[model samples]
Target: MRTAATILDFQHVTKKFGKTIAVNDVTFQVKEGEVYGLLGPNGAGKTTVIKSIVGHLRPSSGSITISSYDLQKEFADAIDFVGAVVEYPMHYEYMSGYQNLKLTANMYPEVTKARIEEVIELVGLQGRIDEPVRKYSLGMRQRLALAQSILNYPQLLILDEPMNGLDPLGMRDLRNLLRSLAANGMSILVSSHILEEMELMCDRIGIMSHGYMIAERNMDEIHHAQTPVYLVRVNDPEEALKLLSEEYGEQLHAKEAVGGRIEVETTLISASQINRILIKAGIEVQEIHEKKQSLEELYLQLTGGAEIE
Candidate 1:
């Protein structure tokens, strides 16, 4: 498989606030044309990382490079290829959304009128594009802020809680829009407290806890690496349970069968092996399937069962 180019690189990055360490010796990279998520609970240093990337706060000790330009050394040039929405939407409440975008475009000499219109449509803000920002709903304002961020057609986009104020339909629309942008080669790094949404939206996720990065893995890796558990259906629940218990010993975890179905928790055994054993023992097999672990389950396990702050 061909490797994607690295668009954002954070090498041994650390951020400190006096006696408090916000981010500690963290290292990660975001590749081109992929949606990367920083998944963490509140106070997990996610916002600090986002702020450092956008040049709002400098890392105490580390190197940050965006599109091959060192952020500290070449702030202007590096930021030219980057755009971000650090937190809540900030806009001129009295100005129309269209005017807000137009003013933002004026800051970039290359931003055109057509590009402004295109982003408004892309973010589904065309209906309220002419309305004053103060009159817009929270979700609409968020969308407008997103549109402004992309007005310059950045190579890298960093969003801090991009889905914060969106409704269900609004979240769905944002997901689709982000997918389209990534398909067109825009690298994205987004932070979110919503686990399920991150599971669906991100190509890969980095889990952070308390100020440290605990793990980073793609969805498939998370799914396959968790201890395998399955729900099984058989003719003789007692026999299957007894046989499985005997064969696997302590590795077997048999739950009470409900309606002739049994739940087994084991990592060393596969569905096929379970089925074969039951059939060989004259236990009729009605249905058998593997139960995939939810992202929440894996996340809990990785974080030592600590509640998300």
Candidate 2:
């Protein structure tokens, strides 16, 4: 049994197409009110997992549960509490945004006009709700897609490539919208190749590659690569670099950085240790501090330089 108080669960799930394995022995849980990320570069089986969870693709083995109901057995009931966008969410281009939502909402008896309006407003498409979908910008279309997913006030939302093709302002707005959804008790799993955005947007991320989940962790755990390295602008960088490379290469990894500064990667030595080391070598320490490990660096480290296809 999954003991993670899960709102969504995938247990030993596997999917195959002829000879190709799209997803293999994958397992993960998304808890309530949390933004979970299914992160990988393209062709990493992220889309397969999302489709399986939403019941669009049945697993070859194991099972799926949504809100504690088995998807295979409960079927409709299990799917009832879920909203999703597998691949790019397709919308009828000729229809008005409101009309498109109405058509989609009619496919399920639980949705009403008020429910549609609520979702439309929530996705920030209310001002343009009556406009034709074809006239909408790419970001607006993305928002409309999100609106379609939320028409039922679903307890769980599964969005694949939720941030695809959005501008800076759109991504920012979408991030805030997702955070707000989690705050109001909605469990969300977003699948995308945009790892940097996912790092900032998701509460925790589950990384998938080569048809399965390779890693999963919170932000702190993912970016724990921060070391005691500082930038130093010295008067004699040539001398400092040679001296440090020759003597302190084991303890202090120093290299020439931009602006004629020396960036050193060192152990958890203190500020005093930095001063003593520089003074002992007759190298004037211009500045010494710490540097936060960016997600891009950590992503490369964790994924082993695997870029999203």
> Quick one: best lDDT, which candidate?
1
The per-prediction CA RMSD against the true structure, in angstroms, equals 6.3, 6.6
lDDT of 1 by residue, 1-309 (tens): 899999999899999999999999888899999999999888889999999999999999999999899999999988988989988878999999999999999999998888998999999998889989999998898899899999887899999999988999999999999888999999999999899889888889999887888888897776566667688988788888888888877877887556888888887778888888889889999998876667786678777666653
- Model 2, residue 27: C-alpha shift (Å): 1.1
Candidate 2, 167-258: lDDT as tens digits: 88889888998999899989999988887799889989888877878888787765576566777777778887888788767777888987
TM-scores of the candidates in the order shown = 0.80, 0.76
Per-residue lDDT value at 297 in model 1: 68
Model 2 vs. true fold: TM: 0.76
Question: The CA-based lDDT of model 1 is what?
Answer: 0.88
lDDT, candidate 1, at 199: 89
lDDT against true structure, model 2: 0.83
Alpha carbon lDDT of each predicted model: 0.88, 0.83
Query: Residue 195 of model 2: what lDDT?
Result: 74
> Residue 144 of model 2: what lDDT?
89
